[model samples]
Target chain A: DVKVTQSSRYLVKRTGEKVFLECVQDMDHENMFWYRQDPGLGLRLIYFSYDVKMKEKGDIPEGYSVSREKKERFSLILESASTNQTSMYLCASTVAGQGAWTPLHFGNGTRLTVT
Target chain B: DQQVKQNSPSLSVQEGRISILNCDYTNSMFDYFLWYKKYPAEGPTFLISISSIKDKNEDGRFTVFLNKSAKHLSLHIVPSQPGDSAVYFCAARGLNAGNMLTFGGGTRLMVKP
Candidate 1:
């Protein structure tokens, strides 16, 4: 089985604070993604990394950025957190290509509260 | 524009009944569709998927039906159990989208015992 681990389950930060959410996948998948879940909005992609040191913006990536310094680890960074950024963040990884034929293994998720 | 849509925000069904969740997409380029189940605090987990080549795919109590012309798909869960209560998200993948998946707003399904 593939395992994806997020560093934090819950976090609270004041406005304008820098926040970092970490994720690690044991499967060594080449693709990693960051998504935020909000009621009535479902899950929206923040950023995705296809390889180490390569990143692409998703539908909503204005306030967030990502890092993929290593194959197993992907980090989501909020350069300056805002209340609007408070939401459940999810990290997922999958093998390259194959699309829906390949399932994305996800972490439990990190609930960030920006106050 | 919202490419994928789950218009129904919630659904309730009694145990042993069939629960149906619907999803629609506007992008005709999408050839693959998937359903994911998520609990309150957990991330969405892959449920079932159907390719455009097939109209229906079944696994156990879960079956997915796709209509290419309508650009719609439905997931049916028979003998619904309480454990099946969760938010169900519909996702679609276009050939050009690579690993990126377009997700719908999601529908919350509650099963009562």
Candidate 2:
């Protein structure tokens, strides 16, 4: 089974504070993604990395940024955390692109509460 | 504009009954569709998928049907179980979308015993 691990399960941060959410995948999948889930909005992609040091912006990527310095680890950075940025953050990994019929394997998720 | 949409916000069904979840999309570029199930405090997990070429796919008690012309899809779960109660999200991906998937708002399904 593929395992995706997130460093934090629940985090509380003050406004303007810097927050870092870390994720690591045991399988050497070529793709990693970060997404945020709200009550009715479902899961929206924040950022994804196809390779180390390579990142692409997803639909909602304004307040968030990501890093992939190593193949197995991907980090999501909030330069200045805000109230609206508080949401359940999820990390996922796949062996290849969706076109290749690979479903994303996801972590338990980190619930961020920015106050 | 929302590319994918799930009209129903919630659905309730009794055990041994059938649960049907619907999804619609506006983008013609999408060539693939998927359904994911998510529980509270947990990330969404892939459920079932159907390619544009095929209209229907079945696995156990779960079956997914697609109507390409209508740009719609539906998931049918027969003899619903309480464990199946969760949020169901419908997702789509196109050839031009690369590795990303666009998801609908999702519908919460409750299966009662």
TM-score of each: 0.97, 0.97
DockQ of 2: 0.66
Q: Write the per-residue lDDT of candidate 2 for residues A1-115, one digit (tens) a residue.
A: 9999999999999999999999999999889999998878888999999999999998899988899999999999999999999899999998765455778888999999999
The global C-alpha lDDT for each of the candidates, from Candidate 1 onward, is: 0.93, 0.93
Expressed as tens digits, the lDDT of each residue in B35-101 for candidate 2 is 9999988888999999889999999999999999999999999989999999999999987665578
Q: What is the C-alpha DockQ of each candidate?
A: 0.68, 0.66
Q: Which stretches of candidate 1 lie over 4 Å from their true place?
A: A98-100
Each candidate structure's count of clashing pairs: 0, 0
Best by DockQ: 1
Q: Write the per-residue lDDT of candidate 1 for residues B3-104, one digit (tens) a residue.
A: 999999999999999999999999988878999999887878999988889999999999999999998999999989999999999999887677788899
Pairs of residues clashing in candidate 2: none
